[model samples]
Target: MIEQEQVLDALRAVYDPEIPINVVDLGLIYGVEITADGDVTVRMTMTAPQCPMSGYLLQQAEQGVRTVAGVRNVKVDLVFDPPWEPSMIKEDALKSAGILTDTPANPVEGDCSTEK
Candidate 1:
């Protein structure tokens, strides 16, 4: 059986084309599942649905995770149901991005909360 930690480590290597940070740190990767046969499934989303590089980025993530020794198959699912907001970013990622502003980058309208 493949360890979940190993799959996470592989995910840490993928990055978004527009961001200087990796997808894991950016909070783009929502979930990861490793099946008994070592197949991996990743659920992820982009900052925006119209992101031109979404295809390329997802492909890279799938390929990168497949490079892990125990992984036999990789599948990446792209979703945008909840939509992505700057608030979803990890604290460390925000700090690294130098985004000290208390305001959310793409505020939706009435949802006001500084805490994520």
Candidate 2:
């Protein structure tokens, strides 16, 4: 029987082209289910539904999971009910990217137009 943890590790191999963190750590992976027959089901979502790379990301996730030793089939189901936010990023993942783990009190907003 294929271990669920191994399958999750495989799924974590997929990375968003724009993000430094892998999808799993990015909180995009909502759920993973493995069946007795080796079929796997993955429910996931992107940072934004309008993201142009959504199709590519989904395909990569599916392909990545299939590479697991005993995974016979992979089904990726995308959802956006709760919506994605930067706060969803795991603390470890944020730390790996060198992002401050502490919540910024009174976050600052800079106007990019002034730089020009």
All candidates: TM-score: 0.80, 0.83
Off by over 4 Å in 2: 101-116
The digit string of per-residue lDDT tens for model 1 on 2-100 reads 887787788888888788778888888888999998899999999999999999999989988998888888999998978988888788877777865
Clash pairs, candidate 2, are: none
Give RMSD to native, each candidate.
7.1, 5.3
Cα error, candidate 2, residue 67 (Å): 1.0
Best candidate, lDDT-wise? 2
Error of 2 at 88 (Å): 1.4
The parts of candidate 1 lying over 4 Å away from their true place are 101-116
